[model samples]
Target: MSYTVNCSILLTDLPLLERPAAAKAAGFDAVEFWWPFAGSVPGDRDVDAFVGALRDAGVQLTGLNFNAGNMPGGDRGLVSWPARSQEFLDNLDVVAAIGERTGCRAFNALYGNRQDGCTPEEQDELGVQNLVRAGRAVQRIGGTVLLEPVSGADAYPLKTARDALGVIAQVRQNGADNIRLLADFYHLAVNGDDVAAVIENHTAEFGHIQIADAPGRNEPGTGELPLQQWISRSRQLGYSGHVGLEYRASQEDPFAWIAAWAHV
Candidate 1:
């Protein structure tokens, strides 16, 4: 029953800063977000407004993504982009600062898309290095860095749990044991991963779990996914972290689809 509203995608009718309160009104005490700022290191005023929103809404921050560049423009992340490695590093300072204030410990680090000039091997190696750095930085706050496998982006690598775990293995081998898999069930299902088997085999490795009924990325019962069963299975298998409601709303009120989490 530990669930968190992903305010970034859920309450779209409200302003970015206003969504946290909307989520709280919808009955979720914990919330998460994608990078809320338009820039990697937001101005002090912007950061204060953001942290203030969460405080006013009285919601606990459970999960957050490091600044993934231009998401609306299709940039998945900068963790592996050699040219933006410094930007990614600088972004971590802000992420750590936010975590320090909100008591958030789970951070999602999306892997960048395949670049035009760089070979896959080069990006992969660079990715491991960046992840190791992030892992070490967040570990000071008793945090865990989450690497998620995304769907719908062909150029974006790490399309499945095994693929993400492979990169996590490299990070672990490099001495950053704080890194872990962010098992996003919708992405895994869309990529043809066996959801049940993934939970059964790697429940111990999951740092956080997110869900959307796939085929449309809508709420449960709108799509064909057996989400409640999968959620129950994950909990039964000892996955105690928050389940992030990270999906696009098919209707004006997305939470209506789940009936205030009763159906979910």
Candidate 2:
């Protein structure tokens, strides 16, 4: 029953270097981030410092995202971008290095948005190719590559558990069985999918589970989604993984919703 805080969205008020400690103070022993650096392949020294901050905070690095191109501005990923495929491949070594150092075993690789000139099929083909290679690299350190569904992502193709699972199957077929779906309840609900049904049917297929109350992506008690119940049900269905608290806090005591973890 490990719970991890997503520093990427959790501690927007604090400096990047201080977020891990803040999360630790809030009682989260595990932390996850969406490529803290602005670029896909940041220098080694910068990575070392970031990793050091997590260590000093005494929190486990439970999950991480590969360099999703310009996430805040809307670029979802680089793997599928024809012009950036090589750069995406090159970044794998960096991810593998970070994985080795932090002992974080799960990596989320967003499937990039649809390009103007590239057809969806072409984008899918390139993404799978790069993802397969990424899966292999992460496998060296005993890690899994996770695919996620994004809401309101017109260019991003994956919008449901089934959609991500489809891509996972393709990657596995290409010989990387370490690929798995990242079942994020918030995105699933926002996309109008039956989140409960997804949990019951795809639990075993999930490598990780992330939660944020739907509609507003805020603390659990502030939203309508029964996240705690879904988390409990997910575990009952055989999903043994970290439940990442990838939500923004609306309350001053960001961890007030932690009570829901035990209640569920």
Candidate 3:
């Protein structure tokens, strides 16, 4: 698997419009990002500007997230909240249009942390309904909808690859087979899963793969996880998707980490 820069975590020192060019300068022709701009749905001008930036930078958008709700404000995601289902659904069209513009074929929809006064059953029901719709939308665009296991610290329900896979299965049962897993190694490692084994055993089931070192969600080689071993093992297992660089850039030039992966 090759690498794709996650601009949301990287190039923070630069403006959003400049990050894709920065990634391109760093030798990455592909990039992915969480929701850009201040809200779930930005204006058409903002969306056009974003797509234009990617095009002007000559970078491919391999993946994108549906509105997860004010990420910096602790809104882990809103896709599963019953009351926010409409907002989530509305955000789908926005992301789908962006995907069409960028030729991106993967969309990740985060299942938010549990909310006050809402039952798990209600959240799950709403989540299924929304994901089914999302799955169908992306399917029309020749894309795959993704579900990822976020950290427990965020109080999010899905905390492991298996957790996301279970939901993927449920989403499939609800009549959307386009749903797949977004396997983030750092979260799985933090949650105490055998990350390497997961890759070796379930690589075929993953739609996207992201990585950061364990103990600290920093760049590869900055923490305890044998990122190279697992990454290399992933390629050996025939997992052909890009291994997204979703880790935080260190104090030093973050682009340097890209070279260190060369020996892997």
Q: Which portions of model 3 show Cα errors greater than 4 Å?
A: 152-154
Model 3, residue 178: distance off in Å is 0.7
lDDT of 1 by residue, 215-259 (tens): 899887788988888988888899888889999888766777665
List model 3 lDDT by residue over 63-86, tens digit each.
999988878778877788877778
- Supply the TM-score for candidate 2: 0.97
Clashes of each: 0, 0, 0
Write candidate 2's Cα lDDT for 87-113 as tens digits. Answer: 788788888899899899999998888
Residue 196 displacement (Å), model 2: 1.0
Tell me the whole-model lDDT of each prediction, alpha carbons only: 0.90, 0.87, 0.86
Off by over 4 Å in 2: 260-264
